[model samples]
Every structure is written in C-alpha cells, then in structure tokens.
Target: MTLDAPHAASRPTTSDELRAIALEQFASVGFAGTSLQQIADAAGFSKSSVLYHFASKEALLQDVITPAIDQLEVMLDRFAGASDPAKGRARFVDDFIDFLLRYRLEVHTFINQGQSLRGIPVIDRAGRLIVRLSETLCDETASTEDRLRLGIALGGAAYTLVAGATFFEDEIAPADEIRTALLTVVTELLAPVTVATGPRTDRNQKA
Candidate 1:
C-alpha cells in the first residue's frame, strides 16, 4: 500500500482509495480549496460515495492527518527508546525532518490554513500529539524549555524544508537533498549542551 498515489482496483480498500485521492487534492488545493466533487471525480466515485466513505470534509481531513500523526508517534516512540542520547537525538531530529519531507503537502496545507484548520480542533490536537511525542523524545535530558525549543525547531525545520523543496526543486540535483539540508541544520542547532533559550512551547506541549 503506497501512500504516494491512489490505485483503485477491486481491492476492498475503498477507504484507502478515498484517502489517497483526498490527500492528493488537499495537497494541490488545500483544505478550503478542495471540493468533495473534485476528489470523487478524480477517484471515479460520486460525491455521495466519497461522503459514505468519509462523513464530511472535516472527517476526510481528520483521516488524512491521523496517519501522518501516527507516523510521527511511531517514530518518536523509537527515538524515545534509543539507548544513546546522541544517536537518539540525531534520529529524532532527522526523523522530524523526514516526516515533514514525506508529508510536505499535508504539513504545508495544515500550517497554511492553521487559523481555519484550528476551528476543526483536530489540528491543534495533532499539535499536542507532536508536542507529547517531543516531550518523550526529549525525556529527562531536557527541561520544559528545552522540549519547547526542540519542537519549534522541528516546526521551523518543516517550513524550511518545504520551502526549500519548492524553491530548489528544479535547481537542486536531487529531491532528498532538501531533507539532508534540514537534518544538517537541525542536528547542529539541537545540541543539548547549548545554552537553552526561553520556553519552546512547540516542544513541551502539555501531556
């Protein structure tokens, strides 16, 4: 099951097919701009069919964000379980950027319409989830302030990575370089020994 695109067949994965189309449209047109009819047409389904799969547009967005958040949770869980702080931190930072890179469309779409998206509630819920994941990944080594800083760094990294990918897509030799650049910048700035700044709310979101 590739997350890259929708492959509609006789497969009993109508939900997945709907989600795949939703994701593509969301990336192309954003949460507000995308229409159920457009998605249904692209997916070879009627608007009512898409509605049957997902009750509403909000529900479809929820479904899309859920998997992306789940991916973050699983990766952060791995980061928390790592034995070495250095490697763990690296993995965490890299994984953070990698998640954004892999889901650049969703991340960009969410961030761009956060004000409207926040009205949906699950948008902020997703933020809290990421913060929770960061808290665990930061663990005992980081104070409340440190965790927030780390989270902000990840958010900033996401923005930079997406913009970088967009700006340099044609100029860059390869697509993966955007993520590599983000990992380098994040790893360098995320040193635990560095003097901490004020509270990074992005990292230490309440449990």
Candidate 2:
C-alpha cells in the first residue's frame, strides 16, 4: 500500500516533512514493520535528527495521525446531538465520505495497523472514537438490521477507499468518481426499507 513520496520541491518545516515521511512508511508497511531508522533514511535525516524533532517513533506516529483524530472528534461531536435520524444519517454519510477521502492514508494506517498498536494511547483513542461514531449513528434502541446497515455502509466505504487504492494503484478512479460511487452505494444501504401492500379487493362488486 505504498503511496508516492511527497515532492521534494515543497518546502514544509522539518517536523512536517518528517511526519509526512513517517506516515507514508506507516501506511505502506505496517507500523510494526517500519522503524525510526527507516523513516530517517527515507527522509535523508539521521536517527538523532529524527529524534530531535520527535521524541520517539511513537511520538512521530502520534504527530502523523493527530490531525485526523482531532477532526474525527469534531465530526463526532457535531453528529452526537442530531435530532433527526434520517437527516443525521444522510449528513453523516456525506461528512464521513469527505473525511475518509481527506485522510485516506491516515485512515489506512488506523484501519490496518491500529489493532496491533492498541496499547499506544493515540491508537486506543482512535479506537474509542470509532466506537463513539457507531453509537452516534445507531443508538441503544437501533435494530440489528439498522446496525448492520450502518456498519456495512461505513466499513465498506473505508475498505473500498483504503484497500481500493492499493488494488487499483495507478489505474484508480478519480477522487470525485470514487466519492460519487461511495455516496450512491452507502446512501442506498442506509435508505429506509419500504414494504408494499397488496392490491385492494373490490368486495362489493364481485362476489
């Protein structure tokens, strides 16, 4: 799941550059497989230099993913008080898709490597956020079917984007196309099911 490295011409600050490199490696090779030395080598910095900017590999990982986690918190808070389930579900689908696209690699890292890195505070926090997200979408009284619908809709979107990126590689569809397809599919999944009534009988006319 390796993405192309950031362009060298962009002059981000040292900490930002290191964070970008670490994120790329973390997403490409699972966090356990990646090392601080590897990130340093890729970024053309010494191990000590990497440490100077980030206290440790864990800290670097935190720096790489903190922004996404922060945004997730904000989105969760906004949807927590949603008074209308139907409208809230629709709004959540829209907002969620945007969030997934905006933080594709970060989501990839969390989805793929989060469990293995569970003891880490940031990873644990991310996991809690995901649970909170599910609760926000479906409350205590939500049906099993509704919960399944929400799970499939949200989980499928994340898997499609993250795994789809690796699967398609160079031939991946454009972002707008992907986003539209996800919205269409997820919206259908979350849509309320309608039961049709049988045709009326003319009791007075035909006996």
The candidate that wins on lDDT is 2
List per-prediction Cα lDDT, in the order shown: 0.72, 0.80
Distance from true location, Cα of 176 in model 1, Å: 4.0
lDDT of 1 at 16: 85
For each of the candidates, the C-alpha root-mean-square deviation to the true structure, in angstroms, is: 7.3, 10.0
Model 2 earns a TM-score of 0.79
Off by more than 4 A, model 2: 1-10, 143-149, 190-207
Q: How displaced is residue 122 in candidate 1, in Å?
A: 3.5
In candidate 1, clashing pairs total 3
Check candidate 2 and list the clashing pairs. none
RMSD of 1: 7.3
